[model samples]
Target chain A: MSAVGGAAVPAVDERVTRVNPLRRAFTRPEMGAVAGAVAVWVFFAIVAGGNGFLTLRGTASYLEVAAELGILAVPVALLMIGGEFDLSIGSVIGAGSMTTALLAAQFGWNIWPALFVSLAVALALGAFNGTLVLRTGLPSFIVTLGTLFMVRGATIAITRITTGRTQVGNLDEVAGYDVARTLFASSIPVGPAALPISVVWWLALVGLGSWLLLRTRFGNWIFGVGGNTASARNVGVPVGTVKVILFMLTAAAAWLVATIQAVNFGGADVLRGSDREFFAIIAAVIGGNLLTGGYGSVVGAAFGALIVGMIQQGVVYAGIDADWVQFFLGAMLLIAVLVNRAIRSRAMGGRG
Target chain B: MSATVSSRVAAPAPPELAGTTPLLEVRDVSKSFGSVIALKDISMSVHAGEVMCLLGDNGAGKSTLIKILSGVHPASEGEYLVEGKPVRFGSPRDALDHGIATVYQDLAMIPLMSIARNFFLGSEPTRGVGPFRRFDLETADRTTRDEMAKMGILLRDTDQPVGTLSGGERQCVAIARAVYFGAKVLILDEPTAALGVKEAGVVLRYIAQARARGLGVIFITHNVHHAYPIGDRFTLLNRGRSYGTFAKDDVTREEVVTMMAGGEELEELGHELEEFARADGLAAGRLGEVGRELEAEARG
Candidate 1:
């Protein structure tokens, strides 16, 4: 209602109303992550003994593995936040690696060209997945699942047909191996500890993803699409386009991760990158991303990857069976998801 | 009475013959889905600086006409004119490109995104060169705040997600966006349907503000109460056919309500109520009370 007698309008008055401090705290994701991070450190330190787990070398090892997984998780988290998924990313990694090896080993292509071809192939595959999901109006999960199997089958068939083996090698001959290794595989030593280049890539990607999600239009579209697609459409957003781009971005990250693995190991396995979709999804969920869409953080996702990476190395450091990693990861995924849901429900004033 | 007189005296010259033509004109448009005819020869015109309310009951083809105008579906037959030139839109984008924007009841905003980001989702301003074209955050925040302020929404912060805003604030933001983007014709679909009385008034004021800025506004609603005061012209629809389109001076609120409920339905309902009252042995003088109840039921 309009105000009378020069009285301030109630709507205007409400705008100036002081927000409840509790409500303000509940609205932010950063506060929750900081608390989670502290809890994680405390838990790991207690389990591994103060000196063993908190050592620089132990931290570097965790950072190394987390960085590699974190790079993929960032884009995967973003895609999830945008209300979509890219199950085919695991296959894209194998596809990228195989392409790189095929170009360099079989065709005598330079490393730069091989890597370029690999990335281009990955982008094309991503575009295909995006287009199919958009055109068919199918769920991204189903569409990318189809692409996942199709690309995996294609990768295995091609690798066996060309090399008469289940694996591709001789990528070392590529002209850009030295540069690739330096960027993706090389390590930086600080005093007695060394940090892998992949860790740096992971950190940079996390930073970029965080900025894009919080401060950019693309980030807004992600939240919009995830929150309510119908509502997003009413507001003039190109919902289909945003979804397609997110799928492509996730695939691109997969390509980057595969490149690092290929260079680091000096070969590609037909079964390489298996179950990475689950890992990336779990990491994202653990990091505070809602599986139903609309809310998430890149830092949270990276931290999720850190948790997984730490558990992986922590098992060996504690002299426990390495095979138990999968069991722990599975349990952690469920617990993290439950925790995330609980936190989200609480944040939304317990409506759920 | 004095307010009505003031409004009349304050009315500017028609301005219909000025440089700008009516932004959107629907000339006897009709549509049918399979066996059901949704809209039958509905003719309406929207000029800049005026509010044209499309009033109808359920099944009156209000949704059908809006779908046609907003490019959700094409009219089965009849002409849609833009700038006095005939045209047909294949999709929502086509309508948008023609400077027509549709704000549906749901508002189409992403609740998880900040207000500034939702305001410029698709057409974000960018800084930097190729391969590094970053979003222009400062511009988006400043413009979103300024535009909302102009529309009488003084947001506490542009950084808050749209979901945090009240229903009325969201509608205002959508309208401000459409206006800011240079929409000549603005079609609002049941914007106040889900809002409370106060929130509905907030949206209505913004609608008036939009009209004042010289944008043709098509305000669709089922509530005659909401339509009567703000609407300059009213078009009534019933079962896919136009009852009539009248200027504000030509019809009263009661007539519009009566028209929406077809004459036959009203008569039938009245007869049923009288018979029931007689059968129940109500006093003769209580007939007026019975008649009023029948009228209310018929209107509803």
Candidate 2:
């Protein structure tokens, strides 16, 4: 024991202890996901033949399709890390797409205006969910769950009444359609394969989310709010504000995904984004964002999305029933959650 | 202990009095919550380099007084003076701005946050421009490690969550934070109540350290035994009223205990215990039985 500033020194226990335990646990999710990914690749390669499963063409196809889900999962992961849920994100996508389609196709608005209006609407919807949750002090799960259905219903009713159909198209005629297409639909050539523009957004968002989660004061507040709201408040971290900001970010991501999908397909479907929120959440949890909050990583979440993408693509590559992808994902989600719980327990010294 | 006290009395007054200026002053502050009078017409002063021990049992208005001083709740009557000037606090932040920091029994710390993160939570250091602005991780880490080291806490890692630290270590961290943030007065609320013997000693040493740094420390604790050893002045409260404030050299530990127990109540309890012992006539070891009798008397 040694003294400093006249304060009594704490005696060192002299007990053998593990060093860098947190670093080990913190990177565990990515390591596990990466290992799972490689195992999946190898399994598919053995079964589907190297040319069919391990080719650059196959990898590019998997990454391109995974890009959209990855883009949405990044912010969803952030929301989960902040200790909240956004079950309405899928419907927010529907709402944003409908807003863009209705404005551009029926109202003859330019794509830029339509996009702005749609994003603004998405922001408002997010703020509404946040306000209700904050005021009621209810779990965000129930609040957003109710909003999911309400938004879905409103999208269907409005689309049918305005267009006499459940779908809207003709967005290609809008000004800035070329810009939208180039950003959302265009592909970048990588050797013999091309990667969709969505992959760029996914990678960019992953980088941004990682930076925000690990290198900002806002990031610290997120962990504080999730870990212990009472303590965070006592220290003046503005818990409510942090939660509201998370919800808004989720909605913004929803809008971005909706824009990409609508422009790439040149239409909007009432059922365009159903069940995507669950997928994003599963991806986040698998990536290692604790469902209970306080411990998680954005990079891990992106990896979780990559795992899902690989499975979705690998099921087809191996000539397995594509329907089995959902079952496989469901099983993987459960196993990931269980493993995360075990790792979390060990890291926290077995305390809840 | 008695001999130590006699020697302390024979020694010259501590060097703390050399400055001869009160750092914080409460002038007849009174507060009431609706129908309940929580605190009434209390006055106290803490000078730099002095530990002013506030002693009371539960519900003795200790919490109310602390809340007023920490600006959690304002006084409904009387005035609170800092540096001999009357002032009112709008919130805890205002008190903090005035260099008054309160460390409650339940320390305000996010248990899952890293020790360095918790140390610089609200006022994190950042580098770069807007959007590019990022946390100054190296500075935060170095400063937290240095500050903890200054407080005699050599953590093996700065990135470990504070939840892993012992109760005493957590208190030391909070105290060090207040001192580092330029707090002139530190108001501690029962910091050692939940700690073990050794942990409590660690905290008491920090209190002395803070006093030595010329910071006024208000130490609230129910254990007169703990306070008697480190206190420069003692103020006892009973049933929301001040018993009296005394300079440490003027009162003995036993006298302080007697005052806290209410001498009349203690006499009545002693009589009852004696009656019970006489009626039973089945003593379980003389000293042990007497200690139990005294404990029972104090409870009454």
Leading candidate by TM-score: 1
Cα error, candidate 2, residue B128 (Å): 1.7
Candidate 2: segments with Cα more than 4 A from true spot: A1-32, A39-51, A349-352, B1-21, B27-42, B74-78, B237-244, B255-292, B295-300
What tier of docking accuracy does candidate 2 attain? acceptable
DockQ of 2: 0.26
Per-residue lDDT tens digits for candidate 1, residues B1-300, read 223222332122134533556678888899989988788888888887889899899888888898899887999999999989999888777888899888887754666667888888767788887656678877887788788878767766676677777777788888888898889989998989889999999899988888888888999999988999889888888788876667777667876777766645786777776776777775654874676676775554
Off by over 4 Å in 1: A1-26, A173-176, A342-352, B1-20, B32-36, B273-292, B296-300
**What DockQ does each listed candidate score?**
0.27, 0.26
Clashing pairs in 1: A111-A175, A231-B108, A231-B109, A234-B108, A235-B108, A287-A300
Error of model 2, residue B201, in angstroms: 0.8
- Candidate lDDT scores, in order, read 0.80, 0.82
| CA RMSD, predictions in order | 5.8, 5.4
lDDT of 1 at B281: 76
Which candidate should be chosen as best, given DockQ against the real structure? 1
